[model samples]
Target chain A: MNAPAQPVLEVRNLSKSLGGKLILDDVSLTLNKGELKVLIGPSGGGKSTLLQCVHYLHRPDRGDVFLEGRSAAEMGRRNICAFRQEIGMIFQDFNLFDHLDAENNVAIALRKVKGLAKAAALARARAELDRVGLADKADLFPAQLSGGQKQRVSIARALAMDPKVMLLDEPTSALDPDLIGEVLNVVADLARGGMTMLMATHQIGFARRLTREIIFMENGRIIETGRPDDLLAPASESRAAAFCAKLTELLGH
Target chain B: MFDLAYYQTLWPRLFSGFWLSLSTIIPAALAGLAIGVVVGTVRGAMFPRFLVAPLNAYVSLFRGTALVVQLFVCYYGLPQLAMWLKPFFAARGLPELWRIFYLSPYAASVLIFALCSGAYHSEYIRGAILSIKKGQFAAARALGFTQAQTFWNIIVPQAARRAWPGCGNEIVYLIKYSSLAYIVTFKELTGTAMTLANSSFRYAETFFAAGLYYLFMTTLAAWIMRRLEKAYAVPGFGRG
Candidate 1:
């Protein structure tokens, strides 16, 4: 086997408190090159906070984010900005700029932050949208697109950044069941293409099929980490096993 | 009595005065709106906490005070302050500072009117900016937009578009209040009407004509505002 590549992302002892309540408690996680790690947890179990904190959106009160062996806090404004360009975040609500059409929404970051000329940035945006199978819908507004299509545009937007790590928070939660497959198929393709992804989701079937690393959380703490069979087997006693069993029963999967 | 005899001479004089009012009011409104955008963004963001209170006080002081009084002080009181500071300015080897005393009355009045208009505009703009969803800020930040970049590139344009209706109302006020330029002896529309009434003893005919003129100007102002709103409105966002 090839020796493991250096860790691409390291969250060291990250703790966050919001509204005087601890939302993240000394959580430490790492993402290696080309690894797909799934975070499965109950609602409000720090999954979203962990993702946001990694991007410095929540600004963890006590921890350092090391991206490619460089601490985020050590960087200046310009450096932190450049550093953020390497990490892409996708939201459940899709958060497309309402004022911009689909193509401009995907192209804005490239033009503004990356300083690409308008034509080049737009061409790249079109290419990414085509990759997500939304080339024809490029002119539609977010309000004009369906939940699934909006999510795909957002995914294409993140892809346009050429990020080294992609952080997705419940990418399928907002979609109708019929639309979930289309978005997941795109994500599954990304994973197969060797994109490093750390995602928080409750899609157990997809988690089982597309990834081997599952981290289950409850009450803002990871209770177990293992492969799907080891953690979700009917005979297992781990909290994760019981949780998945209950989900299966409730969801009738 | 409808004065047909005075129409030729009186109409020409009122037209010249209307030109003066237009020159001052148009620039004042544009400058005020620009200042409003900047101050409103700063006040609404309340970033750099130290400046927030001072900015609030500045806005309040202007919005609360009477514009007539503000104009009185700006026109009459500022000359005294400028006089008192003349030796101080001259001592610094900048005698060109006295050129302020030689400024056109319209320019001086525009300065005060612009600031007063800006205070009102800022309130409208602040409300518009605050009305935008917090998610816009969060999403932009997540996309790696710096605070300055998010504000200038994203927030300002959206807020300006939202502030359009309020700006239209303010501009109507601007057209009528521009007669105040006459108060400071600027010979604007109302001032010309006053001179015509004093000499001809036809206050009813002259002042009534001026009122119709104001109504016409305001109608034109509202029409332009409607066109501006249509031009800048974002598709599929706020139209509903």
Candidate 2:
């Protein structure tokens, strides 16, 4: 049979080192269009580093990341910006501009980058906030929001960009237990809605339920990759099974 | 020798001097802050690396030198330099007007003071810009903002709030440094007090009056800045 169609995002020998310590070492992956890929690994295994490289937040030290077949490393500033418009990345810290209220935070990129008029941006912001179930919180500053709410606002801000691909880096990790469910619910809804996403997370059950494919990483390398059930099934000998067992023990699951 | 009568006698002269000082201080401080915001934003945005380095060098040179030197340069040095280029300036028919504008000691002093303080203020502004979390810039970029749009729309306003306290300190220093303008013969509050004290031979009383004026001005400035800080601070966020 013919090889499956090329993925929407393709990595070829991508590598990065921070201060002479290898953070990502010769990592390669393919993300098919509309695929929900979960990257699960022990801490410092370079899952977030991989997402950041894809987001162009950190340039890979060696090799290439291609977005829709265009080399991200070769794109100039303007092209990079245009490429970024189509790819949204959420942070664990929820990096909202504190001076802006929730609505303005969402509206800013629309107004400044998209060149939308203020009224149009504001309307779009309101719509996105409503989607995140935060219509009433539009005027609230990030400082006023709980960790979960801030993360949701960050999600809305990303969604407002109308991105084709979204990368979430430990989206619920910073939230309190009571708040984690709220953010995870939002991500679940997005995944169910068929938004293309790459999420690095420790929420193993959520990963298994929400994602079609799961990739297990160790020491800056992909140790195993397969369908979620195939790798997570009781009879599996995949390294992912051992990794999940250890993670479950660590999380007291 | 302590005399309530001396204070009474000194009050009017001191009051007039205070008013003169404020006239120079307020306008120069306002102008300096505006220039600083522009320069700081430009430098922070890292526009045209060539331009940024030279602008940075200019800011550093002014901040590194004494304000007195800047005043002397603007007042005494500029005219000499202008005369050297008189052939070019006169051909353009701008030299005479420029000389007339600079001839007034008060105008030249205020101009120099504004330029000097603006340089230091820009440094504070740059520091504030740099202090913002890197993640904010990343988010802006991810949202499709160009470098310029990210700075003006997201960064500068946030940095302004962060930079306010430093800018307030600069404002207080500007007021105090207005006294230096007396050297250029501007006859502001300190200049008037000095001349009056010399003429009256009551140095202690006249100088005491000047001190009181400064105390009042500084107190008012501090109060206003505190209010500003409270207004701009994100509620529930730590002062960091």
Candidate 3:
């Protein structure tokens, strides 16, 4: 018999190339329920591409992604919209809809995709905004919000769907130094609340503090995978460990 | 001059001519707008090369040539074509059919106005659609909006708001150019002014009055556009 509880996400030999350059080369990873995984890498190392491919934002040239054992390839264009409901993605630039206010931003998917009525969507939107600590800022448009606040609202927008997994692509990379803490704090709370997440980020210190699985990538491949303590141990042993050590030292972990 | 006798006669003629202009321009502008939307949508979809090339050629054909020339072709040239089709009509026992091609100025003018103006409108609307950020498209899809839902609900509303200033300019252009109605023996604002000026030989007053009417109409249009731009402007986004 198939296992009653499959992994929340599973990938098999995913590969993607952009402009004839291999960005994600035959990569595979898995996540169980309540697991937090961090993808740490240099720029152009394919962390973002992997997340996007998993979400079908970019279709993989090869391999398959399974959400709870259902292959992404099996989903049609119509099916993809429905499939996306289970996954919430936050972007580096916090791609909130500029035309809508915070409440409408979160509520739109609920109303349009989930078929919730206006008042119900608004009510659900407000609850999620409250969860992200932006209950009062519901009326503000995306352009009116600060970088941190925009990210929190995006998180709220994602959380409002009650998704199974959240894909965060450099969630704090675009924020100012002082503003980074607030956005990371929200992610930490989601982690604590047991949200399954795959985050691509550079803040090694936050990854250290969160105690998640660390997957260090380089040149479109997963070079190392281990717990933070093992990867950031005192000795600059392996290439990944050496990289982690340098990053941790610079990041003041 | 505040001459009541002259005002009475001139007012009726100009008013009647203005009505003719309005009746002609409204339907023609609307037709133009409809054609523009379809053409613009095709352009924005970025279809396969074969299809897009022909659409590009159509836009260029209309845009590159002058409106007056296009109008003349539709009004005058069609009858010349009709002469050749006359033999086919006579053999088919549809003799009157060929004469129907002796197009009414009104029909010809409307077709000409719609086709000519629609070309420009498409460019305005297409530019507005293109200006929408790629992030917005990604964001909509990420939110689980189907492609159609995203276009109608998110993209179109924003693009329409952005396109308003140009659309307003087009409407004003329609009002001024409706004066060309007289070219086909249809008297509109300028036609009325010309007839009254030629008969009365009061060139200064008649033309000046007609010019004032245009100024008033354009000013009113400008004011409305300003309000629309203010109302529809995206909050704290694009514009400073």
Candidate 4:
């Protein structure tokens, strides 16, 4: 009935290497409108590199990425900036500009990239911060906030851009166990709200509860792909199930 | 013997010299800092190596040479070079080009001081810029900020904060080295003191008072720098 809504994001045969090491070999995925997909894999399996390549932070060696049906390779420099603005990225380090307070962190791209007026940008930024439940902490600097709070502020910063899709690269890996839940909660809410997203994370329980599609990668290739019920079942022989089991065993969760 | 009466008589001449020193130091310090920030930002950003290399050479040239030599070249050597190049200019119908090289002593002193201080300040700024984590630049780029916008708005501001103390030290040094202006007959504080001591033969008293003036200036500069560091500091940074 809906005509399949032209896949919101499509990555076809994206390949990359760093320092002569093959980091992503013929990696590919597609995300339809409002759908969330999880990338799970062992360390050095290219999950982070794949997200970066999707964002064009790392140029691919082969193949193409399309956003809303337009190939990123076809875009000029000016168009690339506009294209990047449409995709928000969250880093593992939670890179909120250290000099700015939480509110300015959210408002900066709105003012600089989008050219919003100071008063209007600040108002929108405050609303985003409130959405992340950080309204009272808006005045604080990154160093003054906890790990969870910094990640939330970063999430608010990205949300302020009104990105068409979000790329989160292990947004909670650097956080303490206690701080991880708060950042996960904000992310889970974004998922429920139907913001298209591709996340690289090791939190299997969280992934299982939220998304159906799982992509398992290893040594720069996708080793397995399926729903959590099929791949993550207790007795499944899939690599994804084994990897999730190993992660659970190590984390003792 | 302090010789209070003679020192009193000499006060007016010393005050005028002090005023000249203040005027020279103020403009030179401000110009040097501005140049450093501009040049250092270019060096720190991802500009082509060919472009950044010449600026690096400019820094090395100023830092490697003596300030006295630089002052002499700008004030004295330039006129000689201009005289030699006058024939070349004349062939091009530009006879007045030589006259541009004849800088007033005041101008020459300020030029040398500013350039020398700028070289030092630029090193501090470039180091600070490099010290900032790469993640900041990556984050700005991810937000769709152009390269120039990211450097000016994000990188430069943080680098300026980190480089403040080093730049402040250069100002203190400038206050003391300003005495060198006397070498080219600009007749700043030390020049005035030497003249008074020669006339009255009160060498010890005259020179001692001049020394006190420099000490007062350096101390004042230190206090001002401390206040500025406090004022511009972002809370929760550089803390344990």
Candidate 5:
């Protein structure tokens, strides 16, 4: 694949530690516009931390993230807020505002941050919810919805922002096995529509089918990066391939 | 024996005192809630130390003291403070500052109740705010909400819902405690009852009637609060 002249998102030597323990070390990756990359590894491999650091939720102790070629390290507090607005984040737990119903959850950021009027924001929210096939569930609170429905509402909430790029940290990890497909379908549709995305997920089969490249991380470092076909080939010696074989054996994928 | 004619005359005076009590309780409750919410949000959200220090002091001071003492300080102690500062005001050519210290019994009673209840209310609100899941805060921040917007729009509303029962208890406490207002010469229900009983030498009947009045007020206030709690409750949140 020919690389774009400038990447839409870039992580430069990002490092982070929690409670005096390093979680991510010297992690660097670039995401060109409209590219969807998957981060795969064992639990506690720093994939979630990498996504969070890029979003500045857990500020990196060292290193920088650039969006559209602007360094986050150089941005002021207000500019950081503006920068965060451009990059949407999805969480493993769905994290829908428990107090708000589905429609309000989708509309809140538009009304609050984007300064869209309530009527316009709600209209936009409805459209986004409709896209997720949850238009009928707009008035339901998070607790009232099933896990799959809740995840879709959260995705609608993130999509309503019209984000330049999206960081999804195990968007389907918290779902019941039978419920995972609905959430994955929405994510797959987003990829097909050319929304730039970086995702950390354990569903190797889904990653193999949809992602442009598969990134393997372990012990706070990226171990290997390659196309799914090349990395997961039966005869390959890559760690990702070995991990996938074990995973496939255990889950019969 | 209940004195029918005497009781008939007492009723009008008791009604007037009840009206005064009502006026005091309403504003004090509203103002106290406003102060509690603002103070609670600031403290819970972990604002800068300088601002938090004084608020911490305010909460500690109010909660630690007796309500009667706080009422006394507002009604009586301020005048003494004014006397001490009279020379300073005079030297500064602001003699009007003395008037600020000379609070009327009514004003002083409301002020004391609001401050004391506000302290308790803030504790409840702060606890509720802290109890919220951290993910919501992270999500709001990730969505580009400023700290203030996240606290007000996302955090505070949910906190308020969780804090509702606690705040409602404070309001009931406020209603019952409004009787103490008469201690400051405010001529509220208890004060009027005391005066009438002393003059008529009818302590038992008069005080019993007063007790009934208080019971009525507390019961009414409790019912109103329950209705409000029901109305304000969001679906799938808080106890039914």
Candidate 6:
């Protein structure tokens, strides 16, 4: 039989309100397996909130998230944790454990959560660190790593879990201008390798280059989504075009 | 008037008492610390729940009461309870293992001191555990670690590091409080010094010697704790 095809993640009619203010209003999206989608929007546009909702970090008020056709809402705690293991998330702040060195941080989930033996976990951790090009810095702590290096270690930490889908919420937003390219390069490489990725970023140029599709969000809703080349072109009527115009002007492009 | 002859007469007795005090204090503090760490981490991990509240209440109740009362309750009350049950009495009364092993007044004092200090130390440990960042907990959860795994692997190590200063201070206080062991007829340093003072009527000299010993011990403790703080200190986070 031929391999089956299915959407790896689906969010439908998702709504969330924080402190009586609606942050996400009936948003819906679908991500096919191995697809790279970029969500680009202005600040306070609910991109991060949407990512959190999909990650099940925040429960949507009125919506359903399905991962591999299974309802996220119906999954018990243990299953939900298992689900989270398959979805790797990279945060804007990196969020590396400060007390642990790079290798220990990567090994923690494997050993403590996955119940892998210490020696095996450490060996896997070293391999992941090596994949991130940080094998020599395994003994260094987060504070010791540079901005790009820290983000790489964060990527390594997430990748060590061997997640099926990766979520990046403005992963390069916290880095300096000089440091952004290095992080973006690593992400672009991941995308090229056909990892299922949903990234929310303000970097329109990088998003345009990396993602097969771009979602432009405004006022807690997705305004438009299409091929990045078509949506980002100057003549396109998509709201993404206007946003890209504004962004390009701001960047003096 | 300070007499060198009085000092000479008092020194041996005071030294003996001091040795008893050290023996009692060190073991008691270690036992108390172990109890506090375990109980406090469990309470902290169960926080915002009814279980944590009751444990917190238990800690407060013990801490709020005087150490003297707690000591009496353990030593005196437990025996009555022991005597009430025939099976318990048979097991614990005649030639009991505890009795055989802990025959000295010093051992009884250590047991009492451990229970008394354990209550207060638990609160310190709970506060330290609470001080860990919320992100740390979320990260642990995201990593698929169960509650127990997170507590042991992440929370306990961090809390232990943060709670070290408080624990060190508690140890010094424990040393000072071991003087209370003298009340139970333990001839620890303070008890020995008191007997010597009674005979020679040299209260000031005996107390001065005790004071010097405490100062020396506390200074040494402070130095060791400082070194530990430096060793475990998170780089870029500065001293705890």
List TM-score per model, in order: 0.91, 0.83, 0.94, 0.95, 0.92, 0.83
Q: By the lDDT metric, which is better: model 5 or model 6?
A: 5
Better of 1 and 4 by TM-score: 4
Encode model 2's per-residue lDDT on B1-240: one tens digit a residue.
656687688888677778888988888899989989888877876579887988788898888898888888877887887677767778887736555534567788778778877887888898888888888898888777788778778887888887888899999998899999888887888888899889878888888888889988989999999987887777543462
Which candidate's TM-score is highest?
A: 4
lDDT of 1 by residue, A77-167 (tens): 7677777778988898898887788999999888987889999999999999999999999888888999999999999988999998999
lDDT of 3 by residue, A1-253 (tens): 7445448999889999999999999999998888899999888999999999999989999999999888989889998987788889999998888888999999999998899999999999999999999999999988889999999999999999988899999999999999999999999999999899999988888898895589989998998888888886766375667776677778775
lDDT rank, highest first?
A: 5, 4, 1, 2, 3, 6
DockQ for candidate 6: 0.39
Error of 2 at B14 (Å): 6.2
Off by over 4 Å in 1: A1-6, A248-253, B4-9, B79-104
TM-score head-to-head 1 vs 2, winner: 1
The DockQ score of candidate 3 comes to 0.66
Scanning candidate 5 chain A in windows of ten residues, the lowest lDDT window is A1-10
lDDT (tens digit, per residue) of candidate 5 on A75-172: 98898888899999999998889999999999999999999999999999999999999999999889899999999998898889989999999998
DockQ of each: 0.50, 0.57, 0.66, 0.71, 0.71, 0.39
Docking class of 4: medium
Candidate 6 stretches with Cα past 4 Å from truth are A1-6, A248-253, B5-11, B38-46, B52-116, B180-187, B219-234, B237-240
Residues B8-126, candidate 3: write the lDDT tens digits. Answer: 56766687777777778889889988888777767875667886777778899989998788778888899998999999888888746778778788888788888877888888888
For model 3, the local distance difference test gives: 0.85
**Predicted chain B of candidate 2, TM-score versus the true chain B:** 0.90
Fraction of native contacts (fnat) of each candidate: 0.45, 0.77, 0.62, 0.58, 0.72, 0.38
TM-score of 3: 0.94
Better of 3 and 6 by DockQ: 3
User: Candidate 2 clashing pairs?
Assistant: none
Worst 10 residues of 5 chain B by lDDT: B231-240
B60-80: candidate 6 lDDT, tens digit per residue: 777788877765666556656
Q: How big an interface RMSD has model 5? A: 0.8
